[model samples]
Target chain A: MAINDNNTDSNKSQKQEEKDLPKVVIFLPPPVFSLIGEESFASNKFLFLKAYDSQLPLLQFLSTHSKSIKAILSSGGAAVNADILQLLPEVGLVVTTSAGLNQIDIPECRRRGIKIANAGNVYSDDVADLAVGLLIDVLRKVSASDRYVRQGFWATKGDYPLGSKLGGKRVGIVGLGNIGREVAKRLEAFGCFVSYNSRKKKPYVSYPFYQNVCELAANCDALIICCGLSDETHHMINKQVLSALGKEGVIVNVGRGPIIDEKEMLRCLVQGEIAGAGLDVFENEPDVPKEFFALDNVVLSPHRAVFTPESEKNLSQLVVGNLEAFLSNKPLLSEYVD
Target chain B: MAINDNNTDSNKSQKQEEKDLPKVVIFLPPPVFSLIGEESFASNKFLFLKAYDSQLPLLQFLSTHSKSIKAILSSGGAAVNADILQLLPEVGLVVTTSAGLNQIDIPECRRRGIKIANAGNVYSDDVADLAVGLLIDVLRKVSASDRYVRQGFWATKGDYPLGSKLGGKRVGIVGLGNIGREVAKRLEAFGCFVSYNSRKKKPYVSYPFYQNVCELAANCDALIICCGLSDETHHMINKQVLSALGKEGVIVNVGRGPIIDEKEMLRCLVQGEIAGAGLDVFENEPDVPKEFFALDNVVLSPHRAVFTPESEKNLSQLVVGNLEAFLSNKPLLSEYVD
Candidate 1:
């Protein structure tokens, strides 16, 4: 009877341990579309609250249940600023439902010994497709001509400058990652010969690999930025790179804005340093300089290269999957070393 | 000596005729990119003048040399409205660089007994490529998302939605002409099942032929508009047609704008009557309602689908060649019979 009682207690303890698993406080920084049908977290048992605001409120809420709060999931355009990271000292993990890790301070996470993982490569295909789309949009001047016809200017004495074709053009890819490779494959379909530059030549890739960006630019008709942003790559596309691209060449940036020298790019575009530019990202976003808006040759967007319904879902699945894997003690799919 | 004198006079008359050559008056509308380059018409002795702007000036100039105007070549997007046709009574022939005759009044030409020919099949490849590009852009949400990422909203919460892959999708092309045939071939490379709807079932076309638009839409996942704008095809994509396309279907219009009902289309989109639309032409252009301006579900462009540098130059060559053939009493490549 005593042995049976001990076995019963062991079973109960196992159930209790499963119920008491470290809580994951997912901070809902904003309302998701059709959230009414979404599943809610079980109360007092690994509770997940919807903040729909800043990390300060999240931190304030987490501080109240500090003992059970082992991890935090944050969302929205706002990044994990310094204030929130400093507040959550006991937090073991900070997960983001985004592919970019720029907003999350990796150095601070490293210093605090807290694990930081991002939903990287989830939107690679979506972004790559758009990069090619933007390039085509600019090269063909699709939007500009569309405006011309819609405005009844066809009846006037104006000319829609003939657009260049995409086929048989040399396309230089600055980065050879998932997005870059995808772009290469798609461009290849259109008869574009693709050449790329990366930190090192990838053995798995069969396309022509260049040792440097300038060499790639000099040989190609279009120089596309698909590389990541970092201190080393900050303003990498300076006057030198523009000169290498030449007057007949075009530059299309689908990567981070800091990777290009905005001031230099504008000067080059205005002075015909390069033929034209199709920019999706900017050095300072949502506040593009007045100079950029005035240019007709350049095709400028508000930096929304990966905003799609498919990409959104793909990224969410990756983030949620990573969280599930971490909780289950399986290795994270896209773990950030920092 | 008398025989020599007569031969000399005949030679002089021949030379005079060659020098005159009727001063073939050509009217080019707006948007003809290369404008029948220098060597193209100069060697043939055509006085090239654009009729897109200030038709009064062109009319006055043409009237002065009306007896010399044996032929007229119009290459631009400028419409040869009914008013323009009344002035061409003395003009022996009218040649257009584009295949579309919607802008030219065929009844007026028949009444005046003027021979008419147009450059056909020159822009089929160009138009087909743009149609598929629009389809991919809509299915993938290419432009909208590119707008989102470039705007620096990626660091924020949520993922873009997942898009349907084009591979294995059923594509119904509503014309088996040069453009539709080319589109089907391109879709084949993408692993898509191609079907077509034409006036008469094309015997040589390998793709399955659907006799009706409703039948084609019901069978296919996507529909492409590549037909001509005629009495039979006006408002072809009305509410009933779209209803047959199903709620998850996509429509890509590279054809004339009048074929689709703008009011009905907006209603269909608002009520989720169809999944999405990629329109290169609209029922009433340049005045795309404010409703379409903000939707990510639709992509709008001015009707410049047949635009490309190579195509423009090719079209010019075709126009010149058509003139040469007609002058030599040879059958035209693309003759319009009233």
Candidate 2:
């Protein structure tokens, strides 16, 4: 008895349909894909070609299939720069699974006429929740007290030294974008006085804005860095800014690591020049300074400000939606305009 | 040479004045005194008689100066029971340097016609700050991730598991009291959907009210216990409540520990019946279940939700104010009327 040719033909065409799908080369899998998984993107109109799966080297693989690459998916884990773009001359777009553009070469993408799509406003709530969490952790000593309890210090030693209160605190937010505004809203409910320092003062905002970050740091009890990492903002919180913040001041950074001078901040923390710090990002990720480990006044996280399950789901849908929109010649869901 | 007898006389007079001042017996100093020293109260018109200073025991010290004992300064550290009150025949007032009356015997004091003053509404902001902090810690894995980073897991292991989002979560406040209201206000800014369970439905309030704790837990993604420890509230959160809360639910207790049946909660956590817990108060405090120490999902803290440098300062004034008012025949500042 011969097997039905109909089933065989259907299977062949299914394979053909999957093979014919337009390619979006993933030179690097985003941290988001690690969270929500890339399985959802497979249901879309595009086929993701994972460059790492090829036995050939990254450059050789990119050059071997240059004609097939119409888009590049990037993140903080991978840099989509001029060299990578040079190999993929047919690439028309670059999509980043991150809120910031620091990982990707924006000027190069612009000069090459490549449209960029990013995770816009999808992670605002998650980042804001973590910003407030870190602030409270630093000021209220949540994690420090947790350590005390876990180590059985409460039974042996006693209550840890009292932490400062968040209420009535003057909190200055640097780079008051979506994440900053969300943080300000949460802090306001905690009865904190909110102020902001952006490159230029935002119109229609009620908060008191300072043109200078140092002035903002000087006046506020705490400074929360929510700015992007760029040439202007890199090491923005230098020694002078930290000195102006004074000994009783606290800082919470959910933004990029290098935005604050890490070495200067470490010295200030060690010397009691600043009261405490809560950092979600580091100057060099996965290579945090060992100095931060012993400090009770600091709460360190593994740069997970935007990795909540809800945000991850939202990001997965957004990433797939942006790629599908691009493949269908539709406007990007979250286009990154310079 | 004859020294000035006038200088000696002035010193003698000052000593006499201090000796003649009314004495308020301090049997056991509250934790507040640990944060802010007792020196502030020494400046008052009345002299605080430190019972621990005498060679005699607490009871003997109280009886030796019954005539001088018109008031007792008490705290969570010492219970103001009928045993202690019976020693002071003239004691008409009991002042606690804590927010809750669980540390004091209210019925015994009420029967003897003794007035009670507490740190009313003073620690509300501090407790609320910590309640939100613990909620954030449990939901966002703040303390867990802190440990992960502290143990240098991020370097060896890439990223910790994603935590749940606080926004759009149904947060059930167990008590609609001052601290609960404050917590609700803060969670609202984080975009949480708020409901409550109080003894009586509050008028002019808009949140959904569940009279049953189990029902509240059933509907909420998280439960924040902010009620006091009372006859009706003892072990209010039992096995049934934890079961109703299910596997996705989290809990935070800034209230007295006995409010939740800890053994049942522990079983639920161990069995994965409930997601996680953040506990500041325990049933047998300073002796937390060793099982909790090993659980990454739980964030343990000493009973310090009501403490902060700012709150301690406010409490110092309030404690002294209530005592001064009692001595001066003015109304008690924060009288706990039965």
Candidate 3:
């Protein structure tokens, strides 16, 4: 009986020591963590102090725990700007569960000497899969035919209109990065000829390079945008590029939507200036142009190109890895060096 | 004036000679000819007799033209069985503008020593493209997600359900014929591991062979039915096989529908025994089960797998090539030797 009581006390002390270890803070839990279940992170090295549970306001909660919170796990919805960063003076690192860091203030993080880790190539395959999937859906009219079948139109209207074939089409990939390269690989298997337009030609890439987006659009049957959004690339696919793509051309975008001039592209699609489009991201997401819903030549997705179950699992592993690396002062798994 | 009269008389004689060329009879003009325009075939060597305009019963029409009609050009809906063949004893060749010969009585054609040509391999690429398209649509939920966005569900519901990823999935192709091989190639580009079950182990193939479909289903994450419908293959994917595929399994059918037990498959899908399905061909096409319309896990297409514009062009060329070969007594371009 005495040995059992001593063992119970030691276990409680060990649990207390674990609770005293370094803390990682999350305001609003990321979708990945919630989807995978919060219990999965229960056995990790550090403690996760959820600010949402605090009775105080966010700024007040942060100021109260400023001395204890050493790391922040930011998600797409939570903006990690200078104001938030200034509240946690002891915070040394911020890890995001998304491929893009547009929500995080990068220059501010750098000036404050705080390190950042992103989702890296964890989502590249899923994003590329959706891009190619959207391309095939548009070219083959998969979703439109689905509508035809569901509406009982096939029996009433006879044979559906023939769709264009996928093989042997000329496809130009804008921004031939990780996602673009994967799209190119899959397209090559379908017998499509691949070319590219990037800020700089990739040294190891074998696909044809075009310096101008208009020139690339002119030579290809479809343009797939995979480049990140920045000031220079915003509206890169303008009216000139869409016009150069011609009336028989197609456009697919899995990257940020502002990279394309959405208004000009919509005008082209409406007037039959372009053949079709497959869009997963829009300039203003969740507020898609109502005009697009009436068109048969376009496929609209709900900006979920990177949210597969497999990708979510990968993202969870990456988040844990980044947090572990940050706690130990090791190199971050997917540090945003730029 | 004398020279002009002489040339007109010679042209009349040449016209008569042209009419004496070997005859090719078409009861109903094929859609390919109508699509490409009948003028495209006007310059060919053989003379096509329009039986539809004869103002006679089909049998009587064939009886009257039996001596002139050397070949019959049959489309998908046209039947070239023993009765039609007996009406025209002089007809030695039958050319069909479809891949499947289910419409023609193949055994009777063999018994009558009638040579046959089909639209061989012309639509293989297109069919394979659709198979892969449907698979991606199912795994990634492209059509369903498209519907969600179009119906304003994304704006109201916040986020759509996460779909399964395509990479690293173990896929079993039911048949390793032309279209199956193409499906394997494209899936490999996406990093999926492939195996197959076929009528016989192909000598030149390197993929692992499973003699039993149930075993294959047990081993793979998805099953793609690409085999033709025959007595032996009818209802091959029965209840036992579906059970072996388990709850996370997906099934994609680009093959004929009765290859699967449609009722059992529906039950499994409804009961959540299988994850999802993507069907292009159905047991009763153009009359899909009304129950499927309510299910979000399945993608319904109206049997347009091989009807791409490019494939139609290839089919036209094959038809012309077979007819020309038969007229000149050369080997048929796509002869159905069996």
Best by lDDT: 2
| Structural similarity to truth (TM-score) of each candidate | 0.72, 0.95, 0.93
Worst 10-residue lDDT window for candidate 1 chain A reads A35-44
lDDT of 3 by residue, B1-338 (tens): 35698899999998898778878888787767766567655635788888887899988988888888988888766778888988887788888876666668888888888899988888788888888889889988999999998998888888788888999999999988878999999999999999999978889899899999999999999999988777778899999999999999999998888899999999999999999999998887778888888888999888888888788777777887888888888989888864
* Candidate number of the best TM-score: 2
Candidate 3 CAPRI classification by DockQ: medium
Between candidates 2 and 3, name the one with more favorable DockQ.
2
Per-residue lDDT of A1-338 in model 3, one digit per residue for the tens? Answer: 45697899998999898778888989888878767777655645788989988898988999988998989988877888888899988899998887777778888999999999988899999999999999999999999999998888888887788888899999999989888999999999999999999988899889999999999999999999998877888899999999999999999999888999999999999999999999999998888888899999999998889988778877888888888888888889888886
Candidate 1's C-alpha runs over 4 A off are A1-19, A25-95, A103-121, A145-161, A331-338, B1-39, B42-96, B101-121, B132-172, B181-196, B200-209, B218-222, B246-250, B266-278, B282-300, B320-338
Clashing pairs in 3: none
lDDT of 3: 0.88
Comparing candidate 1 with candidate 3, which one achieves the higher lDDT?
3
What ranking emerges by TM-score with the best candidate at the front?
2, 3, 1
In angstroms, how far off is A191's CA in candidate 2?
A: 1.3
Q: Which 10 consecutive positions of candidate 1 chain B have the poorest summed lDDT?
A: B150-159
Task: Indicate which candidate wins on DockQ.
Answer: 2
Regions of model 2 farther than 4 Å from truth: A1-3, A87-90, B1-4
Any idea what lDDT model 1 has?
A: 0.72
Please give the ranking of all candidate structures by lDDT, highest first, separated by commas. Answer: 2, 3, 1
